[model samples]
Target: MPRSMTLLVLLAGAFLIAGAAALWLERGNAMLLDLSSSVSSFMCL
Candidate 1:
């Protein structure tokens, strides 16, 4: 394979992995935030 093609493929793979990781982290953070908010509301009452 040509050098440019190889580099493109590697970059594409990195981008895919990064995107997946970002999505996973974002979901976890959202869940944590929701849980914290609920707990705070319960404590206030």
Candidate 2:
């Protein structure tokens, strides 16, 4: 049980890291046009 829990934790961490990296790489283009031009803002803020 402990081993499986550890593996699950490691997998979760790896997925999180991978997702963060992907988002960082695509940050410049992400959500660029999701909103209307009048409502668009930097970082969607």
Candidate 3:
């Protein structure tokens, strides 16, 4: 039972880390897209 509990805790930690990493990556992508769009509009003007 103790071993199973430990395994569960580890799995939970892994999932949390993965979620945080995905969120960070998505935010970075959005920032890049926004910058690119702004640059294109400025160039057009």
Candidate 4:
């Protein structure tokens, strides 16, 4: 494959891994709920 294509594939793989990690860490709904609540309050102000 071309150099650019190889780089793109590596980057895409890394992004997928990172996203999977983040979702795993936030497996429970509590954290997201808290975050959304904070954002909602901030938006109302």
lDDT of 1 at 29: 95
lDDT of 3 by residue, 1-45 (tens): 699999999999999999999999899998989999999999999
Backbone clash tally (model 1)? 0
TM-score of 3: 0.61
> How does residue 11 of candidate 4 score in lDDT?
100
Lowest summed lDDT across 10 adjacent residues in model 4 is found at: 23-32
Per TM-score, what order, best first?
Answer: 3, 1, 4, 2
Report how far off residue 44 is in candidate 3 (Å): 21
lDDT of 1: 0.97
Best by lDDT: 1
Q: What ranges in model 2 sit over 4 Å off?
A: 28-45
lDDT for model 2: 0.77
The list of candidate 3 runs beyond 4 A from truth reads 31-45
List per-prediction Cα lDDT, in the order shown. Answer: 0.97, 0.77, 0.96, 0.92
| lDDT by residue (tens digit), candidate 2, 1-45 | 699999999999999999998887687454554544547655577
TM-score of each: 0.60, 0.56, 0.61, 0.58
lDDT score at residue 31, model 1, on the 0-100 scale: 95
Residue lDDT tens for model 1, 6-38: 999999999999999999989899898999999
Cα displacement (angstroms), candidate 1, residue 27, comes to: 1.1
TM-score: which is higher, 3 or 4?
3
| Candidate 4: stretches off by over 4 Å | 28-45
